[model samples]
Target: MVEPLRPPPRSARDDVLTYIKTLHGHQHHDQLVAVRSLFTWAKQNGLIFRNPAGRIKVGQYEYAMLQPLVPVQVDRSVAVATTPATRLILTLVAVHAARVAQIVTFMLNDTDLGNRRRTIAGRVRPPDDLTTQRLLDWLEHRHRRWPNTANLHPLINNQTANTSSRAGSHWISAAMRGQDATLERLRVDRQLEEARVKGPDPLHLAEDFGLDEKTAMRYADSARAQLPQAAEQPSQ
Candidate 1:
């Protein structure tokens, strides 16, 4: 949620910032152009001395994807995960490639235990056997630890279970602290593993994780790039 600096008034008017925030994706560019044209018109009509919008800067939306970590590193992380909650969090990230944010917001209602499917960010994805088992373990642990807690989020600690708030990203990632692979590295490695085993098709990555096309392409391309390097590495 880190944002670049604001327009400083000399660059653009307040309404332009307000307008950009209301739109999504490509609409930001379209809306900004409209505002710039309005300012240009006002300047030509002698209403304003200068077009602040003319000096306004806009940049294309960008996403950065991390390269996959060594497979053995992630394996060590999974092996070291001992607690039910830690194991479940590791499984979700390593197996399902769930984002920390998405995993944190997950509610008890999001799970269909009998069906072995869970709704994450409005998408229904089935957990593999290991993930399902870890989830059950975590549920049992949570229930035993705090039976009367009203907090709905499935992932909760003593502090969070007492209230309605969910676990933070720092807390969740720190669950695997000192491990070889962090949650982010594990998540990227999951997608890369898929692309390595299957074909490195952007469509497949997009479909699997509900990723945007650009994000999918980056993961796919990284997988394709890593394959040859993996082959070249000396056997241990």
Candidate 2:
């Protein structure tokens, strides 16, 4: 009988890189940092002979240049939203580039509809008038549905005090049927819009969006790629 083959054992660095490759974008970078920290701790305590993840460089920021939704798609999504809460959530993401996590975890005190601003993930974001109005309408609906619930989150379902990312994604996806729209894609579109208007300043992009330099540069690169196509279009 032929002997069965066995795979070779992976070193800590190899293991770490393999795991990192499985993730994408900022998540991959975050996981790499965590893995490096764990390995460093292990080395300091003599748990491992050396810090295997120490010298591993962060993965390159590979920009996926997806076509952004046009103005008509945005308008249609807003018009077709099933409920006030769904409309508000879609507007927040499409207009303000708010992350699903930030929207789900948003506190009542963090919002100032009068000023058209809200603090999301420690950053103050100013939503446009339409978004602010949608939020106001949703809050009224939410209050009517669940009075005296004591939940701080603005968006809530029948079962949970706080909405989850999964729920928010599902709501937006349903509202955006027949259109290519997602929270992450909306964020990228927002970033690209900013880059086009602001002349692709990587440093400013990084600071404004709370992203690392490399990731910001990737946005700048993608934005630069679109300039020629934009310029080629005939003026109306």
Off by over 4 Å in 2: 1-66, 72-76, 161-174
TM-score of each model, in listed order: 0.68, 0.66
Clashing pairs in 1: none
Model 2 lDDT tens row, 1-236:
99899888888778777888899887887888888888889889989898888898876655567455698766666676779987887777766667776776777888887776888778887567887889889889988887776677777777664433223545435555565555566777887788888887899788777778887887788788888889999999
Best-matching candidate per lDDT: 1
| Each candidate: RMSD | 11.0, 8.1
The list of candidate 1 runs beyond 4 A from truth reads 1-67, 228-236
Residue 81 displacement (Å), model 2: 1.7
TM-score of 1: 0.68
Q: For each predicted model, how many residue pairs clash, with residues at least 3 apart or on different chains?
A: 0, 0
TM-score, structure 2 vs. true: 0.66
The clash tally of candidate 1 reads 0
